[model samples]
Target chain A: MDGVHDIGGTDGLGPVGYRPEEPLFDNPWERTVFAMSFPAMASGLNLDAFRHGIEKMHPVDYLSSPYYEHWLFTMEKGLVETGLLTEEELRARTQQFLDDPSAPLPQRSDPAAAEAIVGFLRSGAPARREIDAKPAFAPGDRVLVRNLHPKGHTRLAGYLRGKRGVIDAVHGAFVFPDTHAHGLGEQPQHVYTVRFDSVEVWGPGADPRTVNHFDMWESYLVALDGDTDDRAALDR
Target chain B: MSTDHVLPVRPDYNADPTPDPVVVARVKALESLLLEKGVLASETVDRVADLYEKEVGPRNGARAVARAWTDPDFKQRLLADPVAACAELGIGGMQGEDMVVVENTDEVHNVIVCTLCSCYPWPVLGLPPNWYKYPAYRSRIVKDPRALLRGEFELDVPDEKTIKVWDSSAEVRYWVLPQQPPGTEGLSEEELVELITRDSMIGTGLPRTPDSPAGAR
Candidate 1:
């Protein structure tokens, strides 16, 4: 996502706006990823089914955690959820964690559980990202990235703030997100690259030696002057 | 590995998956499946993944950077018809997203960081080495721009002014047009182009010249 701020800069989502001053921690499982945990805990899940529902959640837990922190957290959570270990057992495990020489890897010497974790990890790949062989526009073509700003997980950027460029290549078309991330399922749209001139973008006093180019989605471009047919000379 | 390889040039994905086992495994599993399906070579996935930052990928934004370095009139043209202005040069799109270029200057030096999961302009600049997406770089950068850049990229700019750090989002991508190298009073187009290092071009540092070739401190 490139510089698509809310129309006229309102920070549309209200307070809790972009706070550059607040730097989140370097820990992979920083509190942010788990902010929804409270609601989840309140609205508990129906257990009593198949090796437990969280058997396959290791990948999500692990990738986003700080080193093996996920191992400690997920293990305890998993044990308690499946009734294999009670909350008191969780308490003892916590004390054991404190007493351990070093936190060891998950003892999934059990092949089925290890397999479950493996399957969970493999789920991050795209079933079909819905990308295409050809793009809406190709290299050297003139196009526009429609400037839009909506509150949600955005792929757009803010650096190319009101800037432009030419298409250097039409990287095989991928699904463009209609909402935020393509993960939660999205309406994939066509994307492209539109290059621009340095001097043209920043005023003459800017560098006089290099050109600036950037990427955009089909929705971003607004055919300036209706020069669609002339798109032939675009990438030239 | 050569020390040169450590200076944060583009990264080789073969050895640069995100530092998370699960994430790496998931990606690997998918790549393996893609290979089995004959959709890609077993190594082809590694090679294509390298395009994320290794070979100075998309950079459809380079024309804007080049134009910024070249024609003043074109600069104005960029402000108005950036996409069209880019078409005039011969740079195009990558990642299916339209391209846009931003300029960083003396008053305002722009450095882009994807505070959320390394969303970079891979089409033009190249794959973002693993470290760029590291938590150390991402979490601290926006708050203490000078510190993160200094620690990671070895850039030690003064605290006299607040550096404008632009965080590229998953929705849009960004590329920086670094200042041209110094001492090239009469360099040709190819010479100048060769001088544009992916790092400097991405706003991590300035492009190098014969005098300051390695971007030494």
Candidate 2:
């Protein structure tokens, strides 16, 4: 989905802010939202699904809200949409808190679940899988990013569509986000580090001293013919 | 305290130090619901938060950087296979499952960004800072990184050196292997660890030199 979340190469957002001593999380609520994301996923929601939830948010709300708010929205949307919790229950629970801020939350101690969550955090869930297929392009091979505009979730940034780049390295096959985000399937494919010259991406006015590299799934790229003129392909 | 005085209103909630009361209520509500529905255990959230706050962070990345600076063979291994090299140092997991370390040299410099979302190497760097997830950094960094680095971050790259920005759009996570600072030939690996800051590894700032002022970070 070409949402506000895909904000690469856009301009006039504002200047970046830096705080050298910034805390990991500002609000206690932020911590809760961050931690809950794990168990929310453990409840059968995959990472891509969670991301798509955020992507589905209204553009204005998505941009105006804080980062953790996005996480919280995703968690809530996933839980409710999956029937783990109902809207009325959530609304009543929220009202209870709003009415009595000091209300004690229900707690259940499950040391085993806690341990499992920590273990998973330490040993990540890798998406890489063995596939009996050869990569379409290799290092030094010129490739053009497919001009895709999927209505559903996709990892391909808006600016990268229709752009041309060179294959820098071939990362092993990994779960493709495009299909995975929609619960279609893992659809694991070869991922590559495609290097795009600054001029190629931003055009002639871009700074020549810089280049951009994107980790692109194989399906997102089309192999360019060796005999094809680079300039002609770029112009096209 | 008497509730009689006029309190100052923050113009921007994003910049305000105080937490939003509604957000706090909403999170507590979600927690209560999740707990009641048996979706999450009581201790799970707290434990995960503690793990990130106490155990995981940029210090882990710093240790790897320091070791790579001191050991040439390890540096080669780090560049060749980052995930295994990091695991060799007991640093691997989560968002860092597929890791790539790009080295910064005199001729080339590397930076990491995820314009799609705030995808970072969690096991090594923990949670990303607020600025990293904000629109200002995500939207503009890819287009005019030199300008952003110089104007907002105060790290000016010379015109001659090339800047390579890595957009981590897929499963692979990328980080920078910031060049070891000069005038630290005699320092031990442990001592060298102090020079590596989070921003340096993120490519917004350079590592602290031996003569840099105390508490510079």
Candidate 3:
């Protein structure tokens, strides 16, 4: 949903993927993350050049690092690039770790491991889903996906929300909380999908046959129109 | 860079994966700077660095996922605004911005790969595994999702579906609303919740029968 495309619809243009900027280097991934992440990380930090320095690098290495690996890596990168970590300090730390025979090291690690229930490994596992509760939206309901583009850590996409949509299908619910991504306590919430009309999202002139749906956590949406209007929207 | 055009140990573009000495140096320097600036305490930074990879990392996301699978409407709301739904579950809220969730259906499936740095939905799904950010996996997966998935993740999608690969551009993160698996419908919310594997939610794998979760990795 993000672009500089003239939304006045007077340009006679459709919803096109705005390149944002000229394609940098050859890799799209690198161009995307580098341009985005450091600025976000910079938000929490007190420095500007430090953030700029970190953003200058290609993001290929970033994709090569795991999620938090990048986090860890970036922190280190920022420190070094900004005159915080000295050449000698890194060398000393590396050398010491190599020599320390008694130092504890992590064992097997997995990135997608969190996706599967740990109980899946055990023969008899505790249930992870809570079935008795009723879901928030039904066959037809109007909802909005909040539009937010933050620098440091953000979860919202430009295209998905704000453009009006309806609730087409109701999937089961799961644990959603409000907290920092790292290990910590949480504030409980729920999730769902509110379908959007291409016409509404792209403007009244959009393809009537086309419909878009996005999954949302309850906290993201506030009802704009009731279910009946949504049902009618979906029927079209 | 994610391609197999194995670099001939060259000068520019294709560099080694070795941790950058300069970057590491910068990290240490930044730590010291933060301390000097009174922005952070050296001992606190050391403590943060110490337990970070372990303690204050991805565990919270795991708990959130487990809780979601156990609750229904929360799941629906989760399906609505992932970030807000997460807030309902007490997971994450406006540390800065909000979040949205997208469900993957039979006709249209959502696959997330960070073409840029490996930006992920860590707050909800936890930190990503190493292979996710691997050049080998990133390059091949988008061009050939079904094949690579079968090879790396051992996942196979039906031929009829169209895969919409999301190349994350901004800091905005994405997660898959994996289809809930069959056979556990009548089971208690708790039992049904047990079926919600994190991988399934990611669209990398599907939930299995209670009897079947025994063999998954």
DockQ of each: 0.05, 0.59, 0.05
Per residue, candidate 1 scores C-alpha lDDT tens digits across B65-179 of 6556666788777655454566576533442143345565665566666653455654455445444554445544444455545655666555553355555533345556566
Tens digits of per-residue lDDT for model 2, A90-135: 8888888899999998978898998899999999999999999999
lDDT of candidate 1 at residue B139, scale 0 to 100: 45
Highest lDDT against the true fold, candidate:
2
lDDT at residue B31 of model 3 (Cα atoms): 36
| Candidate 2 lDDT, B1-217, residue by residue in tens | 9433554321123577677778788899999988887878999878999999999999999999999999999999999999999999999989999999999999998888999989998887788888888777888888878988989888999988999999989888888999988888789999999999888889988999888887665
For residues A1-236, what per-residue lDDT tens digits would candidate 3 score against the true structure? Answer: 12221011122111111121221222322322222233234334222222223344355443233233344445455555545555576566545444553343223233233112121211111112455657766767766565544343223345554566677655454333223332122233345555555556566654343344444555566665654353343333
Model 3: residues >4 Å from true position, as ranges? A1-236, B1-33, B42-72, B93-96, B213-215
**Clash count, one per candidate:** 104, 0, 85
Docking class of 3: incorrect
- Candidate 1 off by > 4 Å: A1-236, B1-32, B35-64, B78-89, B215-217
Tens-place lDDT digits, model 3, residues B1-217: 4433654322122233444444433334333344444434223322322222343233444344445555777768776666667656555521103344556677866666653334466556544544444444444443445655565566777666665555442223566666656655566655655555556655566666778747573
Model 1 chain B worst lDDT run, 10 consecutive residues: B9-18
Scored by lDDT, model 2 comes in at 0.87
lDDT of 2 at B131: 83
